[model samples]
Target: MYETFDDTLLSRLNEPVPRYTSYPTAPVWESTTPEVYERHLSQIAKRSNPLSLYVHIPFCKTMCLFCGCSVILNRRPENEETYVNYLCKEIELVSAAIGGRAPICQLHFGGGTPTKLTQDQLERIFFKIVSAFPLDAHAEIAMEIDPRTVVEDEGAKLKLLKKLGFTRVSFGVQDTNAWVQEAIKRRQSLEVTQKTFRLAQSLEFQGINLDLIYGLPFQTVATFRETVHAILEMRPDRIALFSYAKIPWLKPHQKAIKEETLPSTHEKFGMYLAARKLLLGAGYVAIGMDHFALPGDELVEAFKAKTLRRNFQGYTVLPADDLIGLGITSIGSVGDGYFQNVKELSTYYQLLDEGKLATFRGKILSPDDLLRQWVIQRLMCDFAVDKAQFQLKFGTSFDGYFHQERERLKPLIDLGLVSVDPVSVRATALGILFIRNISACFDRYFHKKEGPRQFSKAI
Candidate 1:
């Protein structure tokens, strides 16, 4: 077993920590039926609040060996068209459930590669969403892009995306090292990434974010530093640095990588520290666990103003509200409850063909679930929890419910990972590195089933 926070922190951090993207994470989603999801929409309608929509496009041209996300590869073009058609149907079904259009404050497209679809597919999907919902005039629309697959015709695609109201783009650039790229089967060249950024700049997207990863196979501190320097040169509005999660059993394709080639736990920590130092020195502000943005970036500003929030898609400046997820394996949150779509493409398609919503599973937040979620979200986003705020929002004394958790965390406090006061529990600098473990103390599902260690490391 691990001992000592410094000696054991790195290993413990890597020991299947929840992303804390959602409390009682997706693994515990069990009652999200289609009817239940419709009820969630109805609840949102009654609340009459601006909503956030998340569209999951799970198709990709090729699978990166290191990827652990829900994605389908080597799919026919017709499969994409079929998925889009079903997505349109889902929009109509959700719109009808809400009675009329509800204002959307944010819309984000994430995927195996959201840009894998042709221009026409994107247009059809976005147009359908716009027609079915009342998108706020200042709403932020964003998409994730795979630079390797983007074409010269991207100019036209950008024009259409802008016209359709997309204001931000995040491109994946895990590592610039050719050997690391080859090991992960991502194979993206630095030149290609540069070209993509230049093209995006020409198109004048409101914001550009570069997604970089550390701890990939064959990634050294020197190589990663060079990659960061190159990225700084690009001057993206935001950057998200992620630690590579190596889980061969959960994601069997990861077995393609030779385990010996990966960086050691200590080495990975060094890489993280080095990259953070370089970025901070270059005038970027660290936001939450793994994101950084320039001083003027909305995310950085949000953090300073205490408006940062944690969501299914990592960190966001957008406020928490109803989140409607469309497409296979997507999850939605309406504040009142949570719902998830069918994971298997066949199941998703079958329901759509039958004119039925394709929800397969879900969970309604019991009061306990909601309380724990609030605690976890605060810890994840703010590195602390205000006891008074907890009581004010949940209408229950924090001491009454979490008295045992306070006892359980005594050891962490002794280890200097956290400091507890009369009003709040704050994570120390050391605790920030292991925030997930601290947050896990409040997770209802942590002890239910050990299951598979399929998630990413905390560091």
Candidate 2:
């Protein structure tokens, strides 16, 4: 049914796409004042629901050329301390707004690099959080760490993190090839990563995740394969193999990377296919998009049972609830709406010092937005959506609302990339590789002008 792999398959994959982290993704959020954020928080507290907390640490010791996250580079340690104080003030304001401590089921620290915080600062910030929020005894606290920044003495710090109630840790390891490392300006050695891995293991952290990128400057199939093999040997509970999103025009730093040196679309696809085969052979189950987990891992089991969820942090087994984001540039999902803090440090500090919420922009989802979000989230996580559930939740037939998507998917169905029945729509194995494109059909906001070009590739 398909023609040449080049024009038909590979070319199809090259289309610019959204990651579908959210339906009306963060880009759609509009500027909101501190008053609106406080009102939003009050509305959430009234619901008496449990929430997840996402704290952003936007400082990095050095910039990685391939990185697309919002971060400040090479800031002094004093800058970190200043950031922490404002964060504490913001936390206090949120706590007061909530009326009291609300129970939390999940807490995650994502970066620039969360580990850049000194132990004392880490303790102070976390202490305020624990005091302000009622954390479940089985709550999961996770943080992303850069192996290069973590020292041997920080072993005790890892222990302290556990004692402070962190349950999971993730580290970034783009590629093991020295040439690739040199090009990206992130030169973490195997030794440093190994040490961090072993230290986490010794401390008995509940889960460990290793992140690897497939397409980078100077990376060959062989070098990528070696990185995959090394990761398999290390045996992390989870692995995320992401394709490098090369958007040089958007991220000016990336322009330093010669485009000619980057992998071709086909080459990058080959690397993904090869690494996937190796991971499968080693007994890792593919859990939704880009994530692989061992059979015993919770994510793998969740995938099989169809209980997995996809969030801003990628595929997760955690339950969906309100998520409160802290620190600069962090976004939070509370109830049916979303809010984000001020992204710049100066704005973040000024608002907090005045004892106000630092919210700059946010979106309160309309009923249509919520319905579309449900459909898109299901498509992303399960690779399928139940038509009956769509009707039940939205009081509208999926056929009536998404007639265009139905028409669009007809070609994919004919090509055996998807299966459509009255009750459900599912992505075939081939379709899964292009899930971003498939999911985009449900995105209403995606068509609004063109979104920012800084985003990585959909594949």
Instruction: Kindly list the per-residue Cα lDDT of model 2 for residues 1-459, writing each as its tens digit.
Output: 222346456766567777877657877778888898888788878665567888888889888999888889856888998888888888888989977645888888999988888889889989999899888888888999888877567587778888887899998998988899999999989988888899989988999999999889988889999999888889999999988977766568988888888888777887888899999999999888799988889898888788887777788777747788898878888777788888789988888878889888888899888888888888888899999988998889988888877887776787677888998989988888777777877777765544563456754
After best superposition, candidate 1 residue 33: deviation in angstroms?
2.0
Error of 1 at 139 (Å): 0.7
The deviation in Å at residue 397 for candidate 1 is 2.7
Clashing pairs in 2: none
TM-score of model 2 (CA atoms): 0.95
Question: What are the per-residue Cα lDDT tens digits for candidate 1 across 1-459?
Answer: 122335365565567778888877876667557777777777667666678999999988878988978889846899888888888988888888887645888999999888888889999998899889888888999998888767556566766777777999999999998888888988888888998899889889999999999988999999999999999999899999998877677778988888899888888888988899999899998888889999888888888877788888889988647798898888888766778898888888888778778788877888899889889888888889999999899898888878888887887797788888879989898777678888987876775664444567676
**335: Cα error in model 1, Å:** 3.7
TM-score of each: 0.95, 0.95
TM-score of 1: 0.95
lDDT minimum window of 10 residues, candidate 2: 1-10
